[model samples]
Target: MEGFLYQASIYLAAAVIAVPIAARLGLGSVLGYLMAGILIGPAFGLVGQETADLQHFAEFGVVMMLFLIGLELEPRALWDMRHRLLGLGGMQVALTTLVIMGGVMAMGHQWSVGLAIGLIFALSSTAIVLQTLSEKGLMQTKGGRSAFSVLLTQDIAVIPMLALLPLLAMPGGLSSRVNEATDHSDPGLINTAAAHGDTGMSLVDGLPGWGVTLVTLAAVGAIILTGIYLTRPVFRYIHVARLREMYTALALLIVCGISFVMYLVGLSPALGAFLAGVVLANSEFRHELESDIEPFKGLLLGLFFITVGAGINFGLLFGQPFLILGLALAVIVMKGAVLYVLGLVFQLRGRNLWLFTLSLAQAGEFGFVLISFSRQQNVVPGDMTEILLLIVAMSMMITPLLFILYDFLSRRIKDADEALEPDDVDEQARIIIVGIGRFGQIINRFVRSSGYETVVLDHNLAAIQRMRQFGVKGFFGDPTRPEMLHAAGLKDARVLVAALDDPDAAVRLVTFARRERPDLHIIARARDRTQVFRLYQAGANDIVREMFDSSLRAGRYVVENMGLTEFEASELQRTFYQHDRHSVRELAALWDPDMPTVENQEYIARARELEAELETMLLSQLEDSSDSDSDRKSA
Candidate 1:
């Protein structure tokens, strides 16, 4: 227990120290975790053999993560990705395997060895890729989604790869070491099951292929059925206990039980968990489940990444530095080439194409399982297995750098190719709207519907094209560019709307426009009170807080539900809005751009005073209305 506490302390301490620094430096948390692992395990020797075992346990994080991801995706959404999953994902595995295999064969290895190596390298790290994509907020992009489809396909392909591995086992190829280690553990996460010793359970053991298939099918069926029919009642039962901990326990029970079943049946536990999540995607309790599982998933995933760094066979790597480094780079380059072409073939362009290519270039965590399994199956030589392990770890370690590079390239890509010039504005309108995002779109429609000519300009080519489909004429260009603004007729425009999604960009545009055309009536969209002050300071005639109006409507709705008439509620809302707007203009004068709001005593005192005044005025109005109503009734 003492030893365990020490180990935990070391890991937690390392994370606390490293992660924030990495985040500050823009290196991402994953890389920080990896670096921490390397420090504690390899460089400092604070951790040792337990690293491999810990990694296996940490891999549960991946299962939990898949469950969460599945919760986000309905069956219909998963079905919609069928084409990319089959076409893009399937081809990537096949082509990458064949290419890597051929390369291995060229290096004087036998066909079986080459094929084993190929299968191992074909897969990318789903945990790392998905986590990184999510962190960077790129998971919803065309490239990120495509990458996810391929990762999902690779996971499914692991089953077939495992089945085919033993078939390639050479006659008398088993080394004594391998013979001693053959325990038929599940794929990935090292020899976790074997390390823990046999549980004496036999669901798929010694079964014929058909029998195993039936068992697999039945297990999957049970998960789906449980999700659809059983989870609700189970949750409701747990809810009766009125313990927040019970919900967490139940969520864990669902994941762990499904994982154990999958392990017993020789299937991917992560895949089973994912399947269960998809089944429950539309459940009323989905959000509750997500909230319960999210913390565990995050911690475990972080531990898993740390273990990966700790488990690196640095001795082997240093012994053959060039050979290992060369192999790792080769895998990344070969896979990158395949993904790039696939991206092009599938119509991925600009930043997205580069994103898709760079993100999946590294060998994944699953490679560890395949490499170890191959050794037990005698498909890969012992010496080659160590090299492959090093290569996989090194590649996984390099993934974050690839993501950083993608960030760099994405900035340069700017949504369109450099060769694609901006659309020329042949005509000008009285009203010019910059950035045709949600905010500007409504204004454009309203102005146009009222028989007013308006010019729309946006940086997103896709958004512009989509708007054009709705018969809204929007030119594709960076609205912040001085030349673009001039072409859009900012000089003669009566009203200039800076409704950009980016607060900084909107402020900059407003500042530039105001300076260029002082007479131009510039209305700017602000994300928050801070932005409102910034935009007001930038000389925007009217600064619209994005959520203020919606929030007021919601507040009015609440008041209406609380026994107030709609008219009275609306009057209250109107009074609040007017007071709020006037207070904003007053506070903008006191807002110090150089100082934090909490530190500004004048601003705080004035804000408090305004709040008190508004409350008193609202109470006075309500009292007057009540008195008038009473008088009329008495009359």
Candidate 2:
């Protein structure tokens, strides 16, 4: 109990201090977690010997994370994602593997060893890419969606490669001598004292080479099939346990169980755990399992990155500077080439193509896992693995910067390779409204009553279908597109009014119409000051903030109805209306959490006081007017 408390304290402290600081610095949370691990782990040696052992055990966080990731991805969704899985993702892995393998060969290593190392480096960090995109609020954008599809495919790709690794034997292989270590063979696993003892070994001690391979395959199959058949029932029983903490315990238990099976079969634990997660994706306990496992997964994934960082030997890089540089360049260039071509083939265009390709150019987190696994398999030496791991880590560290680079490149080149221009817009209608919501419908009714022809364009089909049921003449499609505009007859239309609820979409339509039909008068409803700016930018002839203008007209009538002197009523109403407009603009600018605030307390207080005084002034005028009218009547 004392040891557990001591070790937990150390990690807990590291997480609390490091993660927030990293987020504040704009370095991102993953970097912060890794920095914490490095500080407490081998680099600083602050955790001591006892803590090192605990930290190693805590590495289960990553295994659990992968399992949860698998659970979120249903097999059907995965199958639906195959075009990208094979086209974009498969291309990246194959091209990177081949290119890096060639570079390794040029550095005097044989293809057998080079091939193994290259394959390991083909992956990119799924966790980081997904989390970062989400954080940046770009996850639903065209570029963000493309990145997600490619990442999902890569995650699924890792499973097949793990199975394929042992099949890739060394050249002129099969030296049949027991108790003999081959120099040509890379350094195999540093078998621990616990493993060497008679505790676990049974048939592995005397099995032939082929028998050993078969044993591994059989063990793997048994676990996968067992996990498939038993996970749902096991989770159901655990649910009846009715304790949330125990459900978490059960989740961890299941991951460890699957991981152990994979390890015993000489397979990747991450892959097995991931498969277990996939099987449980649709289960009733899925959300509970995810919520329970999320913290550990996050911490462990962070520590795993740090472990990768600590494991990078600077000595190897200094000795083989050129080789390290070559390998890094090869991985990026190869992966990048495949991604670029994929963007074209997959119909990803302009900025989206650039974003998709560049976001995934770096080597992934799984590369570290696989390289560590490959080292144990004797397919690659420790030096080679260490060098490759460092390269992968550096690539990860530069991911944010690379994304920025891709953005810059895309902006500069986007105009040249843009999506095809929309066809000509319609111009024949007597009255055209870009949107058909309540506001637009009112104007549409008024115009139609005047015997003017009215045409409505709305993007939402469901809304249009309902409108059609009411005998409304409305076309359903994106009103922003030129073709849709042309089809709606914008060129001959006497007037165009844009009243879309989404400000951005409305602004887009405003801009498109301005360019196509400069002579037609354009009136747009602005949602707020931002929309006001957008309408102005789009060359709107008249921009109306629906609330602002409505409130102003209402304020004028309210002041007059309250029996105020005419001039006083007009002045008070104007001041208050203008103040309200200014307030909205100021509020919009200050909405961000980090946005700057009013610096002087006195000025802020005075501003509030003045606002109150204006309200009193408006009300006092009404009271004076009321008393004078009574006095005049009595006299």
Candidate 3:
């Protein structure tokens, strides 16, 4: 127990120390976790030996992460992405698998071994790519969405891979040796069945292959049904108890139960969790479940990456440095080449195509699972397993560096493009709107209704067409392009309103407009506090958060519902809005995207203190008004 505690302390300390430093360096938290694992495990020899044990425990994080991802994806959204999922995602996997299989076979491996290895290597890390894209605010970009679609397909593809792996086991191969290699006392249901024989302890046990398949399908169907029918009632009962802890526990219980059922039927537990999440996607409890599980998922995923870093066999790497490094590089180059071609074929160009290529050029976390499972089935040699694991780890480690390179290259390209001549300003308008989406449309309506000459520009052809049908003239072009901004009459426009959906693009436009036309007043729409800070840095004259006004109105309604007069609620809301706007500017000045986590936390604490001070001042003013009212009544 003492040793266990000591190990825990070391792992915790490594994460606590490394993650913040990584974030501060702008390399991101995933890299920090990997670095932490490397530093503690390989470099200092502090936690290297314990990595194997920790790996199994950390894999649950992957399972939980899948569940949260599922919660975010509704069935309708999945349907909408079917083309990209099948075309971009499916083709990438099939092509990559065949190419990798041929390569492995060229090295004198058997067909089965080649196929298994190829399939495993085809997958890219969902955790790393998604987290990186989201953190850098690229998720909404064309490349980011394409990457997401492909990753989702890969996740679903894991189901068949799990089933296919067992069949790929070589006849008369080292099955016994493989079992011995993977032997663990608590190896879970599937491993237990494989080792000790099917005991028929569960209903599906002792079933024929076809029977087991049917049972597996039935189990998945049952999960979907339960999610659709039973979850809401169960959650309602839990919510009635009003115990947040209980709600969290129940959320975990549901995920665990679904995962266990899938495991018993010899399926991917992550797939089962994902299916359950999709079923509950539209449920009111979806957000609640996500909130409850996110922290656990994040911590476990961090541990998982750390273990991946720690588990790297440096001795093997040093012994065959060229072979291992060559293999990893080969895999990345091949996958990246395939993704880039696919991106071009799909009409992606410039920054988007590069992002798609670089984002998914590495072996994913699932590669570890497949390699381990293949070794257990004697499909791959034990020595090969270690080599493959190292390769996967090395590939994952380089993913962040690829993204950093992409950023650097993209900025240089952007800088070069800045010299391009602006488009001819044919029709000068007093007001210019960058985005004619929902927010910009409303603003355009009000501005034009008041008799102002407004020129609107939008990149979305469909949006432009729709606006034209409604008698709104919106030019179709990229608002971030200097030429497009000039064509939209930025020079002559007194006020420029940027209401673009892409926060990064909005920031870029703001920065460019500020630099080019400093006299023009820029009103930018921010999605949240982070965007607010970014836009302020970009020199927006006024930043209006997308939901701030609606939220204030909601607060006023709440105050009125609590028996306050409508006028009083309105006045209170006005005061709060004014104070909040002031606070936003003051607080934004302290916010730095590249700041260390510790400093960011300290800033948050200080902001909370300021909020308390504001509340106290407001209360004192209310008390003084009450006292004055009472004295006037007595007089």
lDDT of 3 at 406: 92
Candidate 2 has an lDDT of: 0.68
lDDT of 3 by residue, 1-635 (tens): 99999999988999999999999999999999999998998788897445776776687787787798789888898789899999999999998898899999999999899999989889999888987887899988999999988998898898788778889887666667566555543221113233222324455667898898799789988998999999989988888889989989998999889878876776667778888898899999999999999999989989988887787778888999999999999999988988999999999887888999999999988887787777777788766877898899999999999999899988976765544443344666988888888899899999999988888887676688799898887777677888878777777879999999999999999999999998999999999988998999999999998898999899889978987677667767877888888788888878878985367876788689879977976677567656876899999
Flag regions of model 2 displaced more than 4 Å: 1-14, 37-59, 133-242, 314-327, 373-378, 381-383, 407-424, 428-431, 435-635
**Could you tell me every candidate's TM-score relative to the true structure?**
0.94, 0.61, 0.77
Whole-model lDDT per candidate: 0.88, 0.68, 0.84
The superposed Cα distance between candidate 3 and the true structure at residue 217, in angstroms, equals: 1.8
* Better-scoring candidate (TM-score), 1 or 3: 1
Model 2 / residue 524 / CA error / Å: 7.9
List the lowest-lDDT window of 10 residues for candidate 3.
Answer: 186-195
TM-score, candidate 1, is: 0.94
Q: Give the per-residue lDDT digits (tens) of candidate 1, residues 198-249.
A: 3368588899989999998998999999999999999989889999999999
Tens-digit lDDT string for candidate 2 (382-440)? 55565776688667766766766765786677554333343244435866887778788
Ranking of all predicted structures according to TM-score, beginning with the best and ending with the worst:
1, 3, 2
